[model samples]
Target chain A: MTAALEARGLRREFGHVRALDGADFDIEPGEVVALIGDNGAGKSTLVKALSGSLAIDSGELYSDGKRVTIDSPAAARALGIETVYQDLALAPHLDPVQNMYLGREVMRSGLLGKLGFMDHAEMKEKTQRAFADLGATVRDFTAPVGAMSGGQRQQIAVARAAAWASRVIFLDEPTAALGVVQTRNVLDLIRRVRDRGIAVVLISHSMPHVIEVADRIQVLRLGRRVATYDAKQTSMEELVGAMTGAISQEEAA
Target chain B: MTTATEPDRDAAAVDEEKPKSTLQRLVGAQAFQILGVLLILIVLFSIAEPDAFLSINNFRNVVVNVSILAIIGVGMTFVIITGGIDLSVGSVLVFSGVVAAKTMEALGGQGVGVSIVGALAACGSGTLWGLFNGVVVARLKVPPLIVTLGTLGMALGAAQILTGGIDLRGAPTVLTDTIGFGRLFGQIPYLSLIALAVIVIGAVILHRTRFGRYTYAVGSNDEAARRVGVRADRHLILVYTLAGFCAGLAGILNLAFFSSTTIAGQSNTALNVIAGVVIGGTSLFGGIGTIAGTVIGLFIPAVLQNGFVIMGVQPFWQQVVVGAFLIAAVYVDQVRRAAASRGASTRRSLFSRFSRPQGARRKEAQ
Candidate 1:
């Protein structure tokens, strides 16, 4: 089967420094791929481009082998590509269901049409299903997300992605600021996403977690992909050397 | 003696939200202050004019007298809830009245079509001025208070220029007589009934629709709302437009009440409308208020002034009392905010304790 997400020659630049100077990465329909890089090594640049928050300067994106251009966040969503940023970008005062169905509320009436109301029942049912899939129970459906802990909020964010995503997902430093238990909860969620036959792209600084969860690992050093190795074959030291541009295929040869 | 640390807190936080909720329902709400004042006035006034002040006709007269301002206060509620103000509403009323009367005079007296055109022109002109204020504040990024203040001056000048400060005396009597004097449901004034109808529709628009939620959301946290794909700028524009429409209707009602349109009504209206809005329980800071509070707010002055006339109080003293009420209401709001802040800081302290280690690590987090 074709990979769920494939990048061919993705390039991006910020003024003088090249953040992403032609990169390609892929994940199979149910596999997890880890992208590791040092600070300012273009991890965020690639994440922003794939999430449709920033335009790619020069790149080709293929999902299930069909080329596509994502001009907006909605367009990326249309392709079933969900990206969870570090900040989570959730409305703190809005409940989980409200945060989940924010922009696309399930309304009974057509836009500017008769009835003039939102269908709260349909939205509640759909969100309940999402929560069930994430293996969590929200105590109060109307309680705001601000009242939730870091772990619960991440679960809601992941659930929101899985509810609509069909092909691939990206997680950007998802464990940042999370407690040990919270990190474990999110790692479990990442595994669950793959178990559902969806490809997962993980961006992280934690090398140990990467080696544990990733089927394959890709390393970027100053915007260029320097190495890719099967998780079973590579060591943490080898991965770290590739990530910092210290290892070269020519040297190994 | 034991000493206690009350707490250092963010006092302004609590006052920033709409108070139409359970907070306003609390006993000792400022709206109840008007009722206290009304009772005091009744007790003092009846001793002086025992027969006259207690008469039913005197009660009816007071309700009728305050009807104009109360009608306009309904419009102000919509404006203030969106965290904006309309200073030009009074001027719009005057300008509209002039247009309506001038239409009657120029149309050769009270024909049905002439009356309809006059009403539309007056209400329509007020709405047009309101739309101008909304566009400047919403799209052009001008402050609401300043834009409406500018329009207030412009509207007054336009009203004066339209008539050269002359009163349009010969208005169509039929139109005014029906609206001002006709009884609805056997005893209710026709104008009051119409005002009631407008208020019901307005309250529904503010409380029951998707439009209402966006209004509250924008006022609450604009950036958060926009990030969630809520078209905030567009929603703000719509809010201002709704305020303008209400202002227009208030002007038309004013014209129908008084046969002659006076340019001076605009002078006191902005302050009065804002005072009435805050009097009801909505916050001046934005994000938390309701039409119900506004209605209660409107009646405070209505009942107070009614009690004053029964005691033969001078008309100028009315302004003093209203001013005092405004200052007192603000003071109460300040006190309420202070207490709420103390509660908030206590909650924050509890949270800080729950995650003390996290706090220590956060400082070294870089």
Candidate 2:
């Protein structure tokens, strides 16, 4: 299968620190890939670059093999790319529908233009489907997300990504603070999207989770891709070694 | 054994819960507190001065005077709900009046359509000042309090310059009498209805719209709002702009009521507007407020002032009462914040019941 998303020689510098150094990644369509790294390993830098939240000093990106530069977060979103940060971008005081429709609401039919209003009914209907398909049971759809469980809220964020996006998704530590059930739910969601021909790049520190959901894994160390492996070929210890800059070919010799 | 144990317990819990009645949940909501306070205040005032406090004439007088302040306070509620304040509103009010007065003067105050043109021109100037304060606060990332304070002086100076540091006299009488005295809904003063309409509209905008939700979200936690892709600064700019426009409206109302620009009218307008917002129960620190609360707050001082004047109470006592009210409201707000935070921390575990699976697992395992 052709790569749905690819990053070539991506380099980013943040003042005195080099966050990314010519990192290259290629994600095939319908693949669940984990971009694994320890803290400060340029995982976020890569994520931002892909999501159009940060600029790269050098490199090229391709969505569906067409070269592209993400100008802004909105631009990235427009190109069927969505990123759910570890700090989920869901607004607490707003209901899931409102949070989902932030910056992009379905405008209702109106006359004289004065009656312009949000087409909440349509948004609610679409959001409900995404939640139901994902097996998220939100008892109160109208409850402000602040009142929802963390897992349920995460589901809403994922649902938001899934509903409005079709090409690729970046999940940043999606199960970091989730319960076992929620972890299972999110892992299942990862698989479901891959089944639908969508490419997913999941960022996670959890070895077991990466092993379970990812079809491929790319480990980053000190702003470089230390290694890439088939999910089944990698072990937790090996990944850990790569992350901590140990167990390299030179180190082994 | 696990199934038998869980099934029996689950059934019992299901029977016990029945998904909680809507009324019970609603009665325990945050908005209920406002209703409770309003009821209590009504009862207390009725008992404190039965004849005067409950009279129709006194009520009309209270509403007419308070309407102007409430008109501005309602907009301030939106600004405060976004974790921002617009102190320049008073000066914006003065500035707007000067614009209207000049417009009226330029029209010679006697043309067939001068009132219409002057009203629009005056209100537009106020809107512009509001937009200025909003833009500076939103785009410059300045602390709203500081920006508004700066604009307050600037707006006042501008007003002085436009009117040449003197009260603009002989505002068109038609606009003045109509705004201040014309009956719109049966017998109520037009100003009172206008204030009511503005407050009602503001309340709907704050409570019902996506913009309203964003304001509350920004005020509650700005980081969370930004993460949600909310243009926090942009929304804030709009909020202050809306507030400034409202301030201008207040200025027009004042000009129409007083029939001229009082170069110093705004010196106390900000004080009264902020005080009214707080008195109505909008937390000074932000996140929670209501137009309904502000409306009540605007009336409290107006009614008190009217009552004192009628009862032959010392005029100085009006100032004293207002000052005391300010102190008390702010004190209550601080206490309420403390209590709310404490309650939240204490109730953290209760909410984690389903919200965080990890927390639940850890708690269960423990």
Model 1 interface DockQ: 0.19
Per-residue C-alpha lDDT of model 2 across residues B1-366, encoded as one tens digit per residue: 234443233222222222335775444333344455556655666677789777887777777878778878877999888878888877887888888878778768565388777767767887787788788887888888898899889989988887779898757778776885777665788888888888888887887666777788788778767754678888887888889889888888888888768787568888888888887778677776777778777766776677666666776787897788778677656654553432121122222234655444323432
lDDT of 1 at B204: 70
Per-candidate DockQ vs. reference: 0.19, 0.33
lDDT per residue (tens digit) for residues A1-253 in model 1: 8877788778888898899888777778888899988998888888777778889899898878888887677778888888877777666545677778766666666763244466677888989987777775344566446545566677788878777789888888887766555567788888888899988898999987888888888887778677888998999899888876778652243
Give model 2's clash tally.
3
Positional deviation of residue B23's Cα in model 1 after best superposition, in angstroms:
12
Off by over 4 Å in 1: A25-39, A82-98, A109-115, A135-137, A143-221, A225-244, A247-253, B1-85, B167-171, B224-228, B279-286, B304-366
For residue B207, what is the lDDT in candidate 1? Answer: 61
Give the alpha carbon lDDT tens digit for every residue of A204-248 in model 2: 989999998899999887777878878998899988988898755
